[model samples]
Target: MPNETLAGLTILVVEDVTSIRSLVVKLLERLGCEAVCEAADGETAWHHLKRRKFDAVLLDFELQSDDGVSIAWRIRGDDGLINKAVPIVLLTAHDEARIVEAASKAGVDDYLVKPVMPDRLGLRIRAAIDKRQDKLDRQARSTEVSWKA
Candidate 1:
Protein backbone atom coordinates (compact mmCIF):
# COMPACT_ATOMS: atom_id res chain seq x y z
CA MET A 1 0.00 0.00 0.00
CA PRO A 2 1.03 3.63 -0.43
CA ASN A 3 2.19 5.87 2.40
CA GLU A 4 -1.22 7.54 2.55
CA THR A 5 -3.58 5.00 1.06
CA LEU A 6 -6.52 6.19 3.17
CA ALA A 7 -5.77 9.88 2.85
CA GLY A 8 -9.22 10.93 1.70
CA LEU A 9 -11.34 8.14 3.14
CA THR A 10 -14.17 8.93 5.53
CA ILE A 11 -15.07 6.79 8.56
CA LEU A 12 -18.31 6.75 10.53
CA VAL A 13 -17.90 5.84 14.22
CA VAL A 14 -21.00 4.90 16.18
CA GLU A 15 -20.36 4.65 19.88
CA ASP A 16 -22.54 5.78 22.76
CA VAL A 17 -19.74 6.63 25.13
CA THR A 18 -18.17 10.01 24.68
CA SER A 19 -14.64 8.97 25.60
CA ILE A 20 -14.59 5.90 23.40
CA ARG A 21 -16.06 7.82 20.50
CA SER A 22 -13.34 10.43 20.80
CA LEU A 23 -10.66 7.78 21.00
CA VAL A 24 -11.82 6.09 17.82
CA VAL A 25 -11.95 9.41 15.99
CA LYS A 26 -8.44 10.25 17.11
CA LEU A 27 -7.15 6.89 15.99
CA LEU A 28 -8.78 7.27 12.61
CA GLU A 29 -7.20 10.71 12.14
CA ARG A 30 -3.77 9.34 13.04
CA LEU A 31 -4.16 6.72 10.33
CA GLY A 32 -4.46 9.45 7.65
CA CYS A 33 -8.24 9.23 7.24
CA GLU A 34 -9.68 12.56 6.11
CA ALA A 35 -12.92 12.71 8.09
CA VAL A 36 -14.54 10.92 11.03
CA CYS A 37 -18.30 11.21 11.52
CA GLU A 38 -19.57 10.28 14.96
CA ALA A 39 -22.92 9.15 16.36
CA ALA A 40 -23.85 8.57 19.96
CA ASP A 41 -26.42 5.94 19.09
CA GLY A 42 -27.55 3.71 16.28
CA GLU A 43 -30.49 6.01 15.50
CA THR A 44 -28.20 8.97 15.02
CA ALA A 45 -25.85 6.87 12.94
CA TRP A 46 -28.70 5.84 10.69
CA HIS A 47 -29.60 9.48 10.24
CA HIS A 48 -26.06 10.36 9.30
CA LEU A 49 -25.94 7.56 6.76
CA LYS A 50 -29.12 8.87 5.18
CA ARG A 51 -27.60 12.32 4.75
CA ARG A 52 -24.01 11.54 3.80
CA LYS A 53 -21.80 8.79 2.48
CA PHE A 54 -19.02 7.00 4.30
CA ASP A 55 -16.34 4.61 3.17
CA ALA A 56 -16.82 2.42 6.24
CA VAL A 57 -18.68 2.25 9.52
CA LEU A 58 -17.18 1.31 12.90
CA LEU A 59 -20.09 0.43 15.16
CA ASP A 60 -20.18 -0.34 18.83
CA PHE A 61 -21.96 -3.49 19.92
CA GLU A 62 -23.98 -1.79 22.59
CA LEU A 63 -25.62 1.51 21.82
CA GLN A 64 -27.93 3.77 23.72
CA SER A 65 -30.85 3.00 21.42
CA ASP A 66 -29.99 0.14 19.09
CA ASP A 67 -27.29 -2.50 19.07
CA GLY A 68 -24.69 -2.98 16.38
CA VAL A 69 -26.09 -6.30 15.21
CA SER A 70 -29.47 -4.72 14.43
CA ILE A 71 -27.78 -1.81 12.75
CA ALA A 72 -25.75 -4.16 10.59
CA TRP A 73 -28.83 -6.16 9.71
CA ARG A 74 -30.78 -3.07 8.79
CA ILE A 75 -28.05 -1.75 6.57
CA ARG A 76 -27.58 -5.04 4.78
CA GLY A 77 -31.28 -5.73 4.31
CA ASP A 78 -32.46 -2.24 3.50
CA ASP A 79 -32.48 -2.16 -0.28
CA GLY A 80 -33.55 1.44 -0.49
CA LEU A 81 -30.31 2.76 0.99
CA ILE A 82 -27.37 3.47 -1.29
CA ASN A 83 -24.77 2.84 1.43
CA LYS A 84 -25.77 -0.75 2.09
CA ALA A 85 -22.51 -1.97 0.62
CA VAL A 86 -20.42 0.12 2.95
CA PRO A 87 -18.19 -2.17 5.01
CA ILE A 88 -19.14 -2.39 8.68
CA VAL A 89 -16.69 -3.18 11.47
CA LEU A 90 -18.26 -3.97 14.80
CA LEU A 91 -16.42 -2.84 17.92
CA THR A 92 -17.38 -4.53 21.12
CA ALA A 93 -16.15 -5.54 24.54
CA HIS A 94 -17.21 -9.14 24.13
CA ASP A 95 -14.99 -11.76 22.53
CA GLU A 96 -17.35 -14.66 22.74
CA ALA A 97 -17.76 -17.03 19.83
CA ARG A 98 -21.52 -16.57 19.82
CA ILE A 99 -21.23 -12.81 19.55
CA VAL A 100 -18.73 -13.05 16.73
CA GLU A 101 -20.89 -15.55 14.91
CA ALA A 102 -23.91 -13.32 15.27
CA ALA A 103 -22.01 -10.35 13.95
CA SER A 104 -20.86 -12.31 10.94
CA LYS A 105 -24.38 -13.43 10.20
CA ALA A 106 -25.58 -9.87 10.46
CA GLY A 107 -23.33 -8.83 7.55
CA VAL A 108 -20.53 -7.20 9.41
CA ASP A 109 -17.32 -7.17 7.43
CA ASP A 110 -15.14 -7.35 10.56
CA TYR A 111 -15.13 -7.12 14.34
CA LEU A 112 -12.76 -5.68 16.92
CA VAL A 113 -12.82 -6.09 20.67
CA LYS A 114 -12.77 -3.09 22.94
CA PRO A 115 -9.63 -1.19 23.88
CA VAL A 116 -8.81 -1.42 20.20
CA MET A 117 -5.21 -0.91 19.23
CA PRO A 118 -4.73 1.90 16.78
CA ASP A 119 -2.39 -0.13 14.59
CA ARG A 120 -4.70 -3.11 14.40
CA LEU A 121 -7.75 -0.99 13.60
CA GLY A 122 -5.82 0.78 10.86
CA LEU A 123 -4.81 -2.53 9.36
CA ARG A 124 -8.40 -3.79 9.43
CA ILE A 125 -9.65 -0.65 7.72
CA ARG A 126 -7.02 -0.96 5.01
CA ALA A 127 -7.85 -4.59 4.37
CA ALA A 128 -11.59 -3.94 4.18
CA ILE A 129 -11.16 -1.02 1.78
CA ASP A 130 -8.77 -2.99 -0.42
CA LYS A 131 -11.11 -5.96 -0.53
CA ARG A 132 -14.12 -3.83 -1.46
CA GLN A 133 -12.16 -1.96 -4.10
CA ASP A 134 -10.91 -5.20 -5.56
CA LYS A 135 -14.45 -6.50 -5.91
CA LEU A 136 -15.55 -3.31 -7.65
CA ASP A 137 -12.55 -3.38 -9.95
CA ARG A 138 -13.26 -6.97 -10.89
CA GLN A 139 -16.87 -6.18 -11.75
CA ALA A 140 -15.84 -3.22 -13.87
CA ARG A 141 -13.25 -5.27 -15.72
CA SER A 142 -15.78 -7.99 -16.40
CA THR A 143 -18.23 -5.46 -17.78
CA GLU A 144 -15.60 -3.98 -20.07
CA VAL A 145 -14.49 -7.39 -21.26
CA SER A 146 -18.10 -8.36 -22.03
CA TRP A 147 -18.72 -5.19 -24.03
CA LYS A 148 -15.63 -5.78 -26.20
CA ALA A 149 -16.08 -9.50 -26.72
Candidate 2:
Protein backbone atom coordinates (compact mmCIF):
# COMPACT_ATOMS: atom_id res chain seq x y z
CA MET A 1 0.00 0.00 0.00
CA PRO A 2 1.15 3.55 -0.60
CA ASN A 3 2.17 5.20 2.67
CA GLU A 4 0.28 8.37 1.85
CA THR A 5 -2.89 6.54 0.84
CA LEU A 6 -3.68 5.29 4.32
CA ALA A 7 -1.79 7.70 6.53
CA GLY A 8 -3.57 8.79 9.70
CA LEU A 9 -6.66 6.72 8.87
CA THR A 10 -8.53 4.54 11.32
CA ILE A 11 -9.11 1.06 9.92
CA LEU A 12 -10.99 -1.92 11.26
CA VAL A 13 -9.76 -5.46 10.60
CA VAL A 14 -12.20 -8.24 11.46
CA GLU A 15 -11.01 -11.81 11.24
CA ASP A 16 -11.68 -14.91 13.30
CA VAL A 17 -8.28 -16.48 12.74
CA THR A 18 -5.59 -15.14 15.01
CA SER A 19 -2.73 -15.62 12.59
CA ILE A 20 -4.55 -13.96 9.72
CA ARG A 21 -5.71 -11.10 11.90
CA SER A 22 -2.16 -10.46 13.08
CA LEU A 23 -0.88 -10.53 9.54
CA VAL A 24 -3.50 -8.02 8.45
CA VAL A 25 -2.60 -5.73 11.34
CA LYS A 26 1.07 -5.88 10.44
CA LEU A 27 0.19 -4.95 6.88
CA LEU A 28 -1.91 -2.05 8.10
CA GLU A 29 1.03 -0.87 10.20
CA ARG A 30 3.23 -1.09 7.13
CA LEU A 31 0.69 1.06 5.30
CA GLY A 32 1.28 3.73 7.98
CA CYS A 33 -2.13 3.49 9.59
CA GLU A 34 -1.62 4.28 13.26
CA ALA A 35 -5.17 3.54 14.39
CA VAL A 36 -6.17 -0.04 13.65
CA CYS A 37 -9.02 -1.67 15.55
CA GLU A 38 -9.36 -5.44 15.53
CA ALA A 39 -12.27 -7.78 16.09
CA ALA A 40 -11.97 -11.55 16.34
CA ASP A 41 -15.63 -12.38 15.85
CA GLY A 42 -18.70 -11.02 14.07
CA GLU A 43 -20.44 -9.79 17.23
CA THR A 44 -17.39 -7.97 18.46
CA ALA A 45 -16.96 -6.40 15.04
CA TRP A 46 -20.53 -5.11 15.13
CA HIS A 47 -19.99 -3.41 18.48
CA HIS A 48 -16.81 -1.73 17.36
CA LEU A 49 -18.41 -0.63 14.09
CA LYS A 50 -21.42 0.87 15.79
CA ARG A 51 -19.37 2.75 18.35
CA ARG A 52 -16.71 4.23 16.13
CA LYS A 53 -16.10 5.63 12.68
CA PHE A 54 -13.64 3.88 10.39
CA ASP A 55 -12.26 5.10 7.11
CA ALA A 56 -12.30 1.56 5.79
CA VAL A 57 -13.07 -1.97 6.94
CA LEU A 58 -11.17 -5.18 6.12
CA LEU A 59 -13.42 -8.03 7.15
CA ASP A 60 -13.34 -11.80 6.75
CA PHE A 61 -16.04 -13.21 4.51
CA GLU A 62 -16.86 -15.87 7.00
CA LEU A 63 -16.63 -15.28 10.73
CA GLN A 64 -16.88 -17.71 13.64
CA SER A 65 -20.19 -16.14 14.61
CA ASP A 66 -21.18 -13.35 12.19
CA ASP A 67 -20.75 -13.45 8.44
CA GLY A 68 -19.18 -10.61 6.47
CA VAL A 69 -21.94 -10.28 3.87
CA SER A 70 -24.61 -10.00 6.54
CA ILE A 71 -22.60 -7.44 8.45
CA ALA A 72 -22.01 -5.45 5.33
CA TRP A 73 -25.71 -5.45 4.61
CA ARG A 74 -26.47 -4.19 8.09
CA ILE A 75 -23.88 -1.47 7.82
CA ARG A 76 -25.27 -0.35 4.51
CA GLY A 77 -28.80 -0.28 5.86
CA ASP A 78 -28.07 1.38 9.17
CA ASP A 79 -28.47 5.13 9.07
CA GLY A 80 -27.29 5.54 12.65
CA LEU A 81 -23.90 3.96 12.12
CA ILE A 82 -20.87 6.17 12.68
CA ASN A 83 -20.05 5.87 9.00
CA LYS A 84 -22.83 4.07 7.19
CA ALA A 85 -21.25 4.53 3.80
CA VAL A 86 -17.73 3.49 4.78
CA PRO A 87 -15.76 1.32 2.40
CA ILE A 88 -15.74 -2.45 2.98
CA VAL A 89 -13.23 -5.01 1.76
CA LEU A 90 -14.42 -8.61 2.01
CA LEU A 91 -11.49 -10.95 2.62
CA THR A 92 -11.87 -14.70 2.43
CA ALA A 93 -10.63 -17.96 0.94
CA HIS A 94 -13.92 -18.55 -0.81
CA ASP A 95 -13.89 -16.85 -4.18
CA GLU A 96 -16.81 -18.59 -5.78
CA ALA A 97 -19.01 -16.76 -8.22
CA ARG A 98 -21.95 -16.93 -5.82
CA ILE A 99 -19.91 -15.48 -3.01
CA VAL A 100 -18.68 -12.68 -5.20
CA GLU A 101 -22.22 -11.94 -6.32
CA ALA A 102 -23.40 -11.95 -2.74
CA ALA A 103 -20.64 -9.57 -1.74
CA SER A 104 -21.59 -7.20 -4.49
CA LYS A 105 -25.21 -7.22 -3.37
CA ALA A 106 -24.12 -6.70 0.20
CA GLY A 107 -22.29 -3.51 -0.75
CA VAL A 108 -18.70 -4.72 -0.50
CA ASP A 109 -16.36 -2.22 -2.12
CA ASP A 110 -13.61 -4.77 -2.70
CA TYR A 111 -13.10 -8.53 -2.55
CA LEU A 112 -9.90 -10.44 -1.88
CA VAL A 113 -9.23 -14.13 -1.45
CA LYS A 114 -7.33 -15.50 1.49
CA PRO A 115 -3.82 -16.10 1.42
CA VAL A 116 -4.49 -12.53 0.36
CA MET A 117 -1.89 -11.19 -2.00
CA PRO A 118 0.30 -8.70 -0.19
CA ASP A 119 1.10 -6.94 -3.44
CA ARG A 120 -2.53 -5.99 -4.06
CA LEU A 121 -3.78 -5.49 -0.53
CA GLY A 122 -2.83 -1.87 -0.30
CA LEU A 123 -4.04 -1.08 -3.74
CA ARG A 124 -7.36 -2.75 -3.08
CA ILE A 125 -7.81 -0.88 0.16
CA ARG A 126 -7.06 2.40 -1.49
CA ALA A 127 -9.39 1.58 -4.34
CA ALA A 128 -12.23 0.67 -2.04
CA ILE A 129 -11.91 3.98 -0.20
CA ASP A 130 -11.78 5.88 -3.43
CA LYS A 131 -14.89 4.10 -4.69
CA ARG A 132 -16.77 4.85 -1.51
CA GLN A 133 -15.79 8.49 -1.72
CA ASP A 134 -17.09 8.61 -5.25
CA LYS A 135 -20.40 7.11 -4.22
CA LEU A 136 -20.75 9.53 -1.33
CA ASP A 137 -19.90 12.45 -3.53
CA ARG A 138 -22.54 11.42 -6.05
CA GLN A 139 -25.13 11.13 -3.31
CA ALA A 140 -24.26 14.56 -2.02
CA ARG A 141 -24.56 16.01 -5.50
CA SER A 142 -27.90 14.36 -6.11
CA THR A 143 -29.26 15.71 -2.85
CA GLU A 144 -28.18 19.23 -3.80
CA VAL A 145 -30.04 19.16 -7.12
CA SER A 146 -33.36 21.00 -7.34
CA TRP A 147 -35.19 18.17 -9.07
CA LYS A 148 -35.83 14.80 -7.46
CA ALA A 149 -35.44 11.67 -9.54
Candidate 3:
Protein backbone atom coordinates (compact mmCIF):
# COMPACT_ATOMS: atom_id res chain seq x y z
CA MET A 1 0.00 0.00 0.00
CA PRO A 2 1.14 3.55 -0.63
CA ASN A 3 2.24 5.58 2.36
CA GLU A 4 -0.46 8.10 1.56
CA THR A 5 -3.37 5.71 1.10
CA LEU A 6 -4.76 7.28 4.26
CA ALA A 7 -4.72 10.69 2.64
CA GLY A 8 -8.18 12.22 2.44
CA LEU A 9 -9.37 9.88 5.14
CA THR A 10 -11.35 11.56 7.90
CA ILE A 11 -10.92 10.30 11.46
CA LEU A 12 -12.52 11.20 14.78
CA VAL A 13 -10.43 11.34 17.95
CA VAL A 14 -12.56 10.79 21.04
CA GLU A 15 -10.77 11.40 24.32
CA ASP A 16 -11.32 13.41 27.48
CA VAL A 17 -7.79 14.67 27.86
CA THR A 18 -6.84 17.48 25.53
CA SER A 19 -3.17 16.65 25.34
CA ILE A 20 -3.60 13.00 24.45
CA ARG A 21 -6.23 13.86 21.90
CA SER A 22 -3.93 16.37 20.25
CA LEU A 23 -1.06 13.91 20.20
CA VAL A 24 -3.10 11.22 18.50
CA VAL A 25 -4.48 13.65 15.97
CA LYS A 26 -1.00 14.87 15.18
CA LEU A 27 0.17 11.32 14.74
CA LEU A 28 -2.61 10.65 12.26
CA GLU A 29 -1.71 13.81 10.38
CA ARG A 30 1.89 12.68 10.11
CA LEU A 31 0.62 9.50 8.46
CA GLY A 32 -1.09 11.47 5.67
CA CYS A 33 -4.58 11.62 7.11
CA GLU A 34 -6.54 14.50 5.68
CA ALA A 35 -8.86 15.37 8.52
CA VAL A 36 -9.24 14.82 12.26
CA CYS A 37 -12.37 15.61 14.27
CA GLU A 38 -12.28 16.04 18.04
CA ALA A 39 -14.73 14.80 20.68
CA ALA A 40 -14.29 14.93 24.41
CA ASP A 41 -16.75 12.16 25.14
CA GLY A 42 -18.94 9.57 23.51
CA GLU A 43 -22.00 11.81 23.57
CA THR A 44 -20.16 14.59 21.80
CA ALA A 45 -18.68 12.13 19.39
CA TRP A 46 -22.13 10.86 18.51
CA HIS A 47 -23.28 14.40 17.86
CA HIS A 48 -20.29 15.03 15.65
CA LEU A 49 -21.08 11.93 13.64
CA LYS A 50 -24.59 13.15 13.11
CA ARG A 51 -23.23 16.26 11.44
CA ARG A 52 -20.42 14.72 9.39
CA LYS A 53 -19.15 11.38 8.21
CA PHE A 54 -15.89 9.95 9.46
CA ASP A 55 -13.91 7.13 7.94
CA ALA A 56 -12.59 5.89 11.27
CA VAL A 57 -12.68 6.66 15.01
CA LEU A 58 -9.78 6.56 17.44
CA LEU A 59 -11.62 6.15 20.74
CA ASP A 60 -10.25 6.23 24.23
CA PHE A 61 -11.47 3.38 26.40
CA GLU A 62 -12.82 5.55 29.17
CA LEU A 63 -14.32 9.04 29.10
CA GLN A 64 -15.84 11.34 31.67
CA SER A 65 -19.26 11.35 30.08
CA ASP A 66 -19.48 8.07 28.15
CA ASP A 67 -17.18 5.17 27.47
CA GLY A 68 -15.68 4.33 24.10
CA VAL A 69 -17.21 0.84 24.07
CA SER A 70 -20.70 2.30 24.20
CA ILE A 71 -19.90 4.56 21.28
CA ALA A 72 -18.62 1.63 19.26
CA TRP A 73 -21.76 -0.34 20.05
CA ARG A 74 -24.00 2.45 18.88
CA ILE A 75 -22.06 2.89 15.67
CA ARG A 76 -22.11 -0.81 14.87
CA GLY A 77 -25.71 -1.39 15.90
CA ASP A 78 -27.16 0.94 13.30
CA ASP A 79 -25.18 0.61 10.11
CA GLY A 80 -27.78 2.50 8.09
CA LEU A 81 -27.94 5.41 10.47
CA ILE A 82 -24.92 6.97 8.79
CA ASN A 83 -23.93 7.34 5.16
CA LYS A 84 -20.57 5.63 5.59
CA ALA A 85 -19.32 2.80 7.75
CA VAL A 86 -16.62 3.72 10.29
CA PRO A 87 -13.98 1.56 11.93
CA ILE A 88 -13.57 2.07 15.72
CA VAL A 89 -10.14 1.57 17.25
CA LEU A 90 -9.79 1.66 21.02
CA LEU A 91 -6.84 3.34 22.71
CA THR A 92 -6.57 2.56 26.36
CA ALA A 93 -4.13 2.77 29.24
CA HIS A 94 -4.97 -0.76 30.26
CA ASP A 95 -4.37 -3.86 28.16
CA GLU A 96 -5.62 -6.60 30.40
CA ALA A 97 -7.00 -9.72 28.76
CA ARG A 98 -10.45 -9.06 30.21
CA ILE A 99 -10.44 -5.52 28.91
CA VAL A 100 -9.48 -6.76 25.49
CA GLU A 101 -12.27 -9.29 25.65
CA ALA A 102 -14.75 -6.60 26.57
CA ALA A 103 -13.62 -4.44 23.68
CA SER A 104 -14.12 -7.30 21.27
CA LYS A 105 -17.58 -7.94 22.64
CA ALA A 106 -18.43 -4.30 22.07
CA GLY A 107 -17.43 -4.52 18.37
CA VAL A 108 -14.18 -2.61 18.47
CA ASP A 109 -12.18 -2.94 15.25
CA ASP A 110 -8.77 -2.65 16.93
CA TYR A 111 -7.18 -2.06 20.35
CA LEU A 112 -4.01 -0.28 21.45
CA VAL A 113 -2.65 0.80 24.80
CA LYS A 114 -1.60 4.37 25.41
CA PRO A 115 1.94 5.61 24.77
CA VAL A 116 2.02 3.61 21.53
CA MET A 117 4.82 4.35 19.11
CA PRO A 118 3.91 6.20 15.93
CA ASP A 119 4.93 3.29 13.71
CA ARG A 120 2.78 0.92 15.69
CA LEU A 121 -0.16 3.29 15.55
CA GLY A 122 0.13 3.53 11.78
CA LEU A 123 0.33 -0.23 11.41
CA ARG A 124 -2.70 -0.75 13.62
CA ILE A 125 -4.71 1.84 11.74
CA ARG A 126 -3.90 0.19 8.42
CA ALA A 127 -4.78 -3.24 9.75
CA ALA A 128 -8.11 -2.09 11.18
CA ILE A 129 -9.11 -0.25 8.01
CA ASP A 130 -8.07 -3.14 5.79
CA LYS A 131 -9.94 -5.63 7.92
CA ARG A 132 -13.13 -3.61 7.81
CA GLN A 133 -12.87 -3.20 4.04
CA ASP A 134 -12.30 -6.91 3.61
CA LYS A 135 -15.42 -7.66 5.59
CA LEU A 136 -17.45 -5.24 3.53
CA ASP A 137 -16.18 -6.79 0.31
CA ARG A 138 -17.07 -10.27 1.50
CA GLN A 139 -20.55 -9.17 2.46
CA ALA A 140 -21.06 -7.66 -0.95
CA ARG A 141 -19.91 -10.83 -2.64
CA SER A 142 -22.19 -12.95 -0.52
CA THR A 143 -25.16 -10.76 -1.31
CA GLU A 144 -24.40 -11.00 -5.02
CA VAL A 145 -24.11 -14.76 -4.86
CA SER A 146 -27.40 -15.07 -3.03
CA TRP A 147 -29.18 -12.82 -5.44
CA LYS A 148 -28.11 -15.08 -8.32
CA ALA A 149 -29.25 -18.14 -6.43
TM-scores of the candidates are 0.86, 0.92, 0.89
* TM-score winner: 2
- lDDT, candidate 3, residue 82? 78
Tens digits of per-residue lDDT, candidate 2, 1-149, equal 35555788899999999999999988887777869999998788889998999989998998988889999999999888886888999998988999999999999999999887665888899899999999989989988958578
Give one digit per residue, the lDDT tens place, for model 3 in 23-105: 98888888889898999987788888888888888899889988888888788787665723677789999999988888888
lDDT of 1 by residue, 1-149 (tens): 33354578899999999999999898888878888999999889999888888999999999978899999999989888877888889999999999899998998888899899988898887787777677678878888843454
As for lDDT, the candidate ahead, 2 or 3, is 2
Best by lDDT: 2
Which one wins by lDDT: 1 or 2? Answer: 2
- After superposing candidate 1 on the true structure, give the runs of residues whose Cα lies further than 4 Å from its correct spot: 1-5, 134-149
Global local distance difference test of model 1: 0.87
In TM-score terms, candidate 1 sits at 0.86
Candidate 3 — which residues are off by over 4 angstroms? 1-5, 146-149
**Ranking of all candidate structures by their TM-score, best first:** 2, 3, 1
Clashing pairs in 2: none
* TM-score preference between candidates 1 and 2, better one: 2
lDDT of each: 0.87, 0.89, 0.83
The positional error of residue 113 in candidate 2, measured at the CA in angstroms, is 1.1
